[model samples]
Target: MSQLQAEYIKRILSARVYDVSIESRLHAAPLLSRRLSNTVLLKREDEQQVFSFKCRGAFNRIYKLLQENPVSGVVAASAGNHAQGVALAARELGIQAVIVMPQTTPGIKVEAVRAFGAEAILHGDDFDTALAHALALGEERGFPFIHPFDDPDTIAGQGTVGVELCRQHPEPMDVVFVPVGGGGLAAGISVYLKYLRPEVRIVGVEPIDAASMHDSLKADQRVVLPQVGLFADGVAVKQVGAHCFEVCRQYLDEVILVSVDEMSAAIKDIFNETRTLTEPAGALAVAGMKRYVKERKVSGQTLIAVTSGANINFDRLRHVAERVEVGESREALLAVTIPERPGSFLAFCQALGKRAITEFNYRYADSGTAHVFAGVELPGGSDERDALVQGLTDKGYPVLDMSHNDTAKLHLRHMIGGPARVPSERLYRFAFPERPGALLRFLSAMGQSWNITLFHYRNHGAAYGRVLVGMSVPEGDEAKLDEFIAKLGFTGHEETDNEAYSLFLR
Candidate 1:
């Protein structure tokens, strides 16, 4: 082994985390085990005092900093779990701490940091912006900056999780799946496991939208993601750390990318097993493990996944529940064109034949054909969806499968009740502050001139409420609509040109 690897092992072994950190439990996931046809274990770091494993690394780093010399205070920038980690660690160590979080961060996280006895400051729109502002403040205040996941001490501190894993699981582990964001936790655990149990494979899981580690590994170097999905906010890091990337490249067997739907289903799975709702990042390992098992067709092997944290807000459950069925292949969405004549709807219903229709929307497109959007629950999986599609095709009904259409899933599904009544329909998506009376603010601006033909907005527990608005604005009145939108001052753009709108609405 290289000298660097040896040093990491030493740091992990001698980590001074016992003062404030507990060895999180490794528990059986009976539901997941039965479903996957293998023994499944979950490292329950969500059971930590802060409901996250981040405290281990934060405390270890803080403890060492105190041992080295006297320090004024520590400052860190984070949108979620890490902020809580530093705050709790600083409180236990009797050191002052300042945590900077993004202005867009959910209210629960910011309040939790302050409750932990740290000074919480909300600034900027996202974590990167908050991080830059925090560094500047740290420099001006002469307080040391505690990086969320980039530093050596932080990575080594997190390595202790692997120590506990090795002690808990003496039996052969086929694979240990870990979630990767900025790569600190994955590096810390994988390197240690590679040293302690060379036979075990380490797989890193990341959301496809925020696959910084996966992209970096593919390029054989660190790469910054241009944009990341905010649904999985805990792992929405744009880039990986330098040292963390090096260690991961050396130790990680492979990195798997999962979708938002898969992560949602994993959240449901973990909830069913442990009665705990984990954040998207926390459930990533379970999601990845399932995908790996299915793709490789591997079975009868013991698999372990780290349930990293449960800092998710309660309101996000609706979104998770909505996507879980599709992610698990238990639901299929379809677009069908049938005759506009009477009794055609009845014929379609008879053809459906009691498959339990989850959702249905229909609107007259013309005198000849009517367009319908429908979702069906499939207990028998993708084969059922295929068979139904073939049956419909054989019956001379034109069908378009929409299960994989993101535009249809995220926005169009809610807007499915057909086209606008008036001529010249234009649709726009708007993002408004998610405060009480926010929708009222938009409506008050719209006035009574244009008829709202289509509107889809359901609260999804986000800082911004997404609204799909279809307005019947007559030609030559476009400038007025533009003027109104500009004066409204909300962030939005026209979705009229989107193909989904043309297919379903126009």
Candidate 2:
């Protein structure tokens, strides 16, 4: 073993998280195990006091700070779970703590941090912005700025989770799936497992839209994501931490990217197994594990997935329920254009034949053909969705697969209106990590300068969400659009030329 690996194991062994955090149980999911024909185990970190395993690292780092020397206080910025961890840890350690959060953070999270006795300061519109404010405040107040991840002490603390898993299971793991956001949890678990249980394969899971670690590994260096999806908000860091990235690059066997639909399905699976619902990020391990198992087609092995956190809003469950069917190859979305005449609808329905229709929306177009956005429950296996699309196309109908279209899912399905002759309308789609006031932040960015022509927003029960905003931009002010979007600190694109937008709302 490397000398650095030895030190990491030592730190994990000496981690004092028991003072504030509990040893989360390794729970067996019999249903899941049977379904997959493998021993599926869930590391129930969501059962922690803060409903997240972050408390372990937070307490460990603060406990070390206490041992090293005298400290004034601690400060951190988080939109969710980490803030609660730092707040409670600080209170337990008899030290003052300050937490900075984005202005758009949910009220529940803000209240949770305040309840733990931290001075919660709301700042900026996103995590990156809030972190900047926290660092500045820490420097000004002469307090130690506690990072949510990245610090050596914090990573060591997180490694204790791996230690507990090995102690609880007492068997060699075939593969372990860990969520990768800033990469702290995966790095910690990877290092510890590599040192003690080298037989165990450690794989990292990332949301496809917010895959900083996956991108970094592909690049052989850390790479910053231009934007992160909010569907799995718990692990939505735009850039993997420097230390966390280095450790993961060395220890992780591979990384898996999961889609929002897969995450929704995983949430349902976890709920079915344990009668407990996990947030999108919390269920990522299960989603990725299932995908990995399907691709590898290896059965009768031990697979472990960390159920990271469950700070999901109640309203988000509906969105999950909406997408779960499609995510598991149980459903698909398609835009089918048929002739605009009587009996044409009946002909389309007869062609689909017994395949369940989950959703269908159509509006009259003053043209020869009419477009219908349809969602249908599909049959089993991966190729079925493709075959269905192909079958529809072969039936003398022009079909556009809308299973992965942002415009189709978020707006076109609901707003299937006839085209309007707006002279200067421009459409843009923006994606941001979802919190309490995410829409408000977008509106703030919009300001009162432009006339709003049309708008659509939907929450897909993931850490990230998207908005389609239509504005009337004058010819002379077109140059300002790029600058405005760049300054928003989130990812967005112009969809004025999108066929759906042009056909329906433009």
Poorest stretch of ten by lDDT in candidate 2? 452-461
- Residue-by-residue lDDT tens digits, candidate 2, 102-157: 87676777888999989999998777888999999999999998999988889988
- TM-score for candidate 1, residues paired by index: 0.82
lDDT of 1 by residue, 411-466 (tens): 88876575545478788998888765565556556666675555555555578877
As for model 2, its CA RMSD to the true structure in angstroms is 13.4
Model 1 sits at a Cα RMSD from the real structure of: 11.1
lDDT for model 1:
0.85
Clashing pairs in 2: 229-464, 230-462, 230-463, 230-464, 231-462, 231-463, 231-464, 232-463, 233-463
lDDT for model 2: 0.83
